[model samples]
Target: MNKDQQPVVLGKIGASHGVNGWMKITTYTDSVTGIFDYSPWLLNERGQWREVKVLRWRQQGKGVIASLESVDSREQAQILTNCEIGVLQESMQNLPEGDFYWRDLIGCEVTNTNGYNMGKVDQILETGSNDVLMVKANVKDAFGKRERMIPLVMEQFIKNVDLLEKQILVDWDPDF
Candidate 1:
């Protein structure tokens, strides 16, 4: 989850399509066609890795229905319900400069202008407009810890992102 690292998440599996091995997928990407490009995709079945082939697929409603090569029954497809799909680190395309995939920003460190370490990014939460960074912060006094969510806005609060150092320099204040 380093800032320099790249990972392509194929999104979560939806309901089974038909009696065949085809299943629906809820994609977060702009185009469902992106998923069909990869021949063999890595499926996360409750965090375990399972390789599945995308024999045929099309976008339907808010998701995509894909026919897996070996999946022949609804019951078999049903087993993949809610499974998360991800590509290997080597499968992603090279991004343009200043453009980063969400997976790359998940574990970068966030520091304020005054050198106060805010937190390390735990995950990225997708909103309709933009994505938010979920930061896991350490509590100095309390025994319990807390997480803070900050918006990834451009030129407003974010100052710089040094991927080589795995750090993000923000203009946010600790009081906020």
Candidate 2:
């Protein structure tokens, strides 16, 4: 995928199922059955793009079993095991009102209450109940510099997010 393209991490291959070319897919969506709706799934293996059509899909106990259009043997399915499926970001639906995808929030500049520059948000952790923003703060020590993570909660932190400017204003203390 191009660097300019928005990543649309669709699903990932979990393990090989039975003796056929079926694969257990752990999808990022709520409904695994809906994965078939998006045809021509893009698989990323060893940093290469491979397009495969969804032949069929069915719900298993906890995950879903998907069979590709051309893959017909266990060996063929093994090649796709652990492969991450994704597409360009433009293919996804637009985010609604207050909702924002993780990709959108990442790379936004973060600042503290006293206008102290924290850093940029590298990623967000979905910690079951609430999400935590991992801010890549460049901390300078004696030797050189390093990065740190600041938890973004509704307490005395993360006041606002200006999507237009791609920035996050927080109410936090720089010294822990």
lDDT of 2 by residue, 1-176 (tens): 56566457878998888778998998876466656656568888897777778888899997799888888988889988999988666567676886666777889988777877777888887676677888777565322324445665655566787887998888766665
Q: Which runs in model 1 stand beyond 4 Å of their true positions?
A: 1-8, 45-48, 141-145
lDDT of each: 0.76, 0.76
Each model's TM-score? 0.83, 0.80
lDDT of 1 by residue, 60-85 (tens): 87667988777899999998898887
User: Would you list the clashing residue pairs of candidate 2?
Assistant: none
| Model 1 vs truth, CA RMSD | 4.2
Q: Which model scores highest in TM-score?
A: 1
Give stretches of model 2 more than 4 Å off.
1-7, 30-37, 141-156
Q: With candidate 1 superimposed using the best TM-score fit, by how many Å does residue 60's alpha carbon deviate from the native?
A: 1.0
Q: Give the per-residue Cα lDDT of candidate 2 at 101.
A: 67
